[model samples]
Target: MKNPVLVALFCLMQTLILAQSPTPSKPRILISTDIGGTDPDDNQSMTHLLMNSDLFQFEGLVSSPSYGEGNKKEILRMIDIYEKDLPKLNKHNKKLAKPDFLRSICKQGRKGNAPFSGYTTATEGSDWIIKCAKKQSEHPLWILDWGGLEDIAQALHDAPEIQHKIRIYWIGGPNKKWSANSYAYIAENFPNLFFIEVNSSYYGFFSNNTEPDTINTSDYYNRVIQGGGHLGMDFKNYYDGEIKMGDSPSLFYMMDGNPEKPERESWGGSFEKITYSPRTIYNQTTTLKDTVAFCSIIEIHLKGPKIEIPSDSVCFWMEIPYGKTIQKWPGYHLGNGDYAIRYIPKKAENLHYRFTSKIAEINGLEGDIVVSNLWPGKKHSTDYPLGNHWYSDKSDINLYDEKIQGGKTVLKWRNVILDDWAKRWKWLK
Candidate 1:
């Protein structure tokens, strides 16, 4: 016979269940990316993944490179952006900027000078991917590939043990009639997997004011730091000659159709339809399959105070001449910036609340970074005490300081960052 109190507790539990109050499920993810791939959307994907690690248990992040000559250096820069930039953010603002993708946050990470700090030693990315897949006792591990299929193809070819252990969700390949120029560059097939072919080229996120290989605006930086605006060019700033795009071109997807529709499926990181093309192979047509479900960019709506990076705040700035070069490919160019962001990866099971919303929006993989103004604390509109809230143009001080003007952040351009923060009076910090 149950005690009267126990019976009462059981009744309460049943009532709660009947009311649809159930716990949420956790998503485990493995991310692979071509960081220096030149398409800016890859950067967005990295940041979104890191910001939303709470909703996903990120297994690993493999930074791969294409066979292209200019691509190698860009690859290294991508790794640095996600790996080395952590210390700088903390030093300047006393806040830790987490990884955009993820590694082992709770595990004992290796220490080094730069990108080698906190990550798995997947020297051979494909082999490493296979090894990780075969050893996973955990079920339903999600693999997100935001780059070339070379590594995955290699991993599959090498290790047949894990052919069915993972469910790959990627943003790649030309699934329709028009194939990518690199169609014949790969040679591995896995039918057990479901692909999310991303029409990344159709994405109009990257802005190109000029081809300044070194000096460029920080669209990625502003997205994580500033808030509220469109993706390509913040409409509020575009009319005044201020552009924020960096060049992920718009030939990836045909947005006329719904991404969930069948025909909408196409290539990864491009806009063109998935079709057999005679462009690359011996001047003859071929069946080039990308993924199962292909779609374009998931436009995220970010709303916050549009702050300005004042020149007077030069004390809160830092930079190096050759900022975004590659590690493996020293010749490539990921971007013009010198700094990258990094953090120790902890299982999403731990930081569930702080980053769940941001992660859920981007499918916990790669797309749109949702930055919240409420990170550690709030900041005043007139001044930033090194907290979360942004300093909008609507702030107390005039966003322009005629005394020190330069860089992409300028008042005349109606853009941010034109002011010289390293002035004699400012006394560089």
Candidate 2:
């Protein structure tokens, strides 16, 4: 026979311990992607997200394009595919979000880049961001930015208070090139916001130089992704089954380890805190001595003859190496003979630019700039020392390979992450 008092005490202790243990909860996630755009990699990332939908409480799926033509239709199309494969996915994970729910959350953001001010009129996507951030929850909303920052900027501009309620993980290298204005706005205004800027670090996803040929980008899809499911069959539509889902790191960061500690090692990649992001301003046309870092925002302010014209009418045309054509960027008119145009050089090359506007004096105003291959990291000096912002530490020797910067961070976990993903793929089949 057992003593009733001792028995009760033991049961009480067990109850207390159970009460103290924290319950695991899915993270609140919202993805802003540039899908069906110039890079079809977002399609791959979106497929990965839908297949692993059980892991997150997805609040929104926004189409936010800064350069190419990406829209909500592309997002809905992927969800349609997911809907077809839902039965197979549900067998493994019953918590996967429904297709109707995903379609309901899909919203369209800005069609083009923001102006020099970094924000324009709010769109449906920005409104959705605000709505989702304002939801009552203990967990902060994690925004996985796989595209431009225009929607995020517009959301912040519209609802500044949401900053405290949300965290951001931005994949910002080539995407930054298109969304420089919005990126500058968020970096400058919302310094204390919890943000992770993975500029070059995400290149690690495809850096298979050190990996075996079986897991290489060219062969991985055939080995692991193909013949898995509808999503798997559609994988070949983009990049011909190559794994260039650079934005998937943001998802991986949330999937594998403690997301709150970005500095700590995880399957996604680790990052370091920095005081500032690179932004350079030129009062006049840049000379050969005024070399700017590639992918960093550069602003040229030209003093032109005073003329009465709307600021929106002004445009700056530049000769770019990648596109092999002259591209036009919007210019802004400031009061008292001042005009400005902000540009991000996508490639390391000599750039020639000319301004055009209804104001004849500013029209045909030309300038030259020397762009270096350097990325906007700690190497550049900044006058604006914002609060500690999380970014890839270029100084970390362990995170880089001989050819790719910050590639080793994700490369080290490639086998483990992909093996896990491969198991999930088997579920679909």
Candidate 3:
């Protein structure tokens, strides 16, 4: 014989406790980053992740620098700092992953972007991705891509079966500029892969457009993160301690909300389903009339005299306006003297290019291409139909920011997200 009032109170308490508790099972995550690369913000993001390591089942930390001098050594450097901070982090949560285990998972991916064909060869990091995706688990692996997609592209190229078992949240934009070839390869081949391409949307994580003064980029690290711990102290080495973890939104997206529904509002910026992604092809050197969208993949096909060279390497060189420097990309020989090169325009400008090969007929072949300001969206007709992919909808008025284009979706949650993180920073103190 139990009292009805007491039983009702007990039920209410249980409901509140359940609502406050984190998900019983941790989400499996594998982070592929270009740490210690051109962008030092990765250091900041890594520090943030280690501080909150308990929230995820971290399976891998891969160094995947597409450009610049970044490698697994940088990841190990961060782990070294984490090792010192582990005592403090463990005080708050003993579930924090061990430094030795994290070091074991640290792998080096490709040193540069993929060739015109997308994937070149598999690396330790790419192999690890395939291995983790194949592991027996009820939940899919969430790959947080903070760098180029070269490794992921290579892994998928090697093991297509894992496409359905893994999800990717890539911090694109500039990274897309670096890994355009691999991006095109994946978009065209693995159309069914569950991916969230956060191009400009991730900018919201650091946007100061409409944020509280306390957590503004210039002040938050000093106020909330500076004295937090060893990791916090080391965070000042990059960007002079200003918080510009543009890649942190991928982490925030999984922190407090349902990652299964990306369209729904979350601390991470909301994304939309886009059937088509921008892409274009040219049979010859393009003119202004044959303008292509910025950041979109453009493939150029050219014909040369039917002469086979003993060597397999062919080069595509594009002349830049600045200092009249030439940047080289790999060109593929498509049998019968046909050659092709895939290029991604990083800006709205005209580009001049030439091909160089051992075959004299293809050597010094020059052409011009016109790039437009048009970006990928409904307004752009030149796009590839991706069967199912999620990306930041640049057309969405609600998510638009005058400063960052499509970063408002994540910008709107700045205060709430930072406040939550600020509370966690206290644990290190």
Candidate 4:
């Protein structure tokens, strides 16, 4: 007989090869977005999601609003457009979910942000989430929270048994500001919950860090996306033809890389590790932020005894991005310990900007302060809505106060003007 040991070894090698084969299985996704609410970028994200529908095993599309309003009608409106373009989309990939099926699965969740407790009874959307979680699946269903977490929170509250079956990828930053109660409840109570709080990583979609070569939102809409088809035309009709889909990174993260392993560098963005909580024995590493360069402006507020400067000496300092010739404006103390400077970068890449002061007391920090795009878009004065700036909490809405406690300097970057780009591009051919 042939050597039994050699035969066994050959079989083991075959198994190993199959295991490393790079072909990743499709991830199951349930999109919970506030599409029709304050920001319309979620609409752009929805368009991208539908365009790449074959990549995911979509379970649900819940209209979970951030504050007290939602747009189930808007969800249907997109579905209507998808239905018109369904035949052509199917030609590209037959796995695309039928419009009728998507319509059937689409449901309206809670109409606003959650109460202090995070639970405000179960809604149709919340119940749907629970139902989807109960289904048999080899992979954990990813709950992509594009808006408030009230629906997901409710689902978890109602059915604690499904906690292990679902993984949450929350696009925090501004969303968390509006849904603080719900976010706080989840963070405080559900330490074991597999959650990836993407606070600032989503900026990669719009950032020009990989400019010229990489197709950003502005370039994508101007070149390939705008006026391409019905979807393109529809996209141009919103945000004045600008291709700002900030929330789409959640989908991109899953679409490009191995969804089973999020830590790997992907189109969504690379993440650093952070300790979850101090109270929990189950210590876990959470995604801190995207490592991508200058996706957004870095606002540094120098304070404490380290930043104390004498009245006789000039306290101004200059910050220059490492390895770059450009230098941002000098930092000036507004009052008290608040020494602030705003940097609008030319490129989007992770680089340490050396902070140097002419005064001897201000010099010598151990390491270069790590700066990356942690917010949405550039530091413009008109990116998001006037009343709903991304950095300002709706509950604690104060635009005038740049210094809001904690000795941190809050930036007054521009708010996005919805439909401004589309209105400007009305003449687009």
Tens-digit lDDT track for model 3 on 279-396? 7767777766677766678777877766564323354454334455556667766667777777777656787766666667667777777766535633445566776655654556
Cα lDDT of model 1 by residue, 189-239, tens digit: 343343333322222122243343423344433433333212212222332
Top-down TM-score ranking = 2, 3, 4, 1
Candidate RMSDs in order: 23.4, 3.2, 3.5, 16.4
Q: Would you estimate the TM-scores of all the predictions?
A: 0.38, 0.90, 0.87, 0.61
Better of 2 and 4 by TM-score: 2
Which residue runs of candidate 1 sit more than 4 Å off their true CA positions?
1-11, 15-23, 67-123, 173-188, 200-224, 227-429
Which one wins by TM-score: 3 or 4?
Answer: 3
lDDT of each: 0.31, 0.82, 0.81, 0.60
* Clash statistics: count for each candidate: 51, 0, 0, 21
Q: Per-residue alpha-carbon lDDT of model 4 for 164-283, expressed as tens digits?
A: 888877776667645654665565556567776666545534544432333344555775556655777788766876766778767766766565555555555444333331111111
* Candidate 2 lDDT by residue in tens digits, 1-429: 199999999999999999999988899999999998989999999988988888999899999999899999999999999898899888888998989989989999998888777898999999999999999999999999999999999999999999999999998888887887788888888988888877777777786574463366788888888898899989999989998888999999999877888888887888777776677888877767778766677877877776676654454444343466566677777656778877877556788776666667666677788877545533445434567654653546555655455667777777787888888898877
Runs in model 2 lying further than 4 Å from the true structure? 1-16, 211-214, 323-327, 346-382
Q: State residue 286's C-alpha deviation in candidate 1, in Å.
A: 13
| Model 2: how far residue 86 lies from native, Å | 1.2
- Among these predicted structures, which one has the highest TM-score? 2
Name the runs in model 3 displaced over 4 angstroms: 1-23, 208-214, 310-312, 322-328, 346-374, 378-383
The ten-residue window of minimal lDDT in model 3 covers 310-319
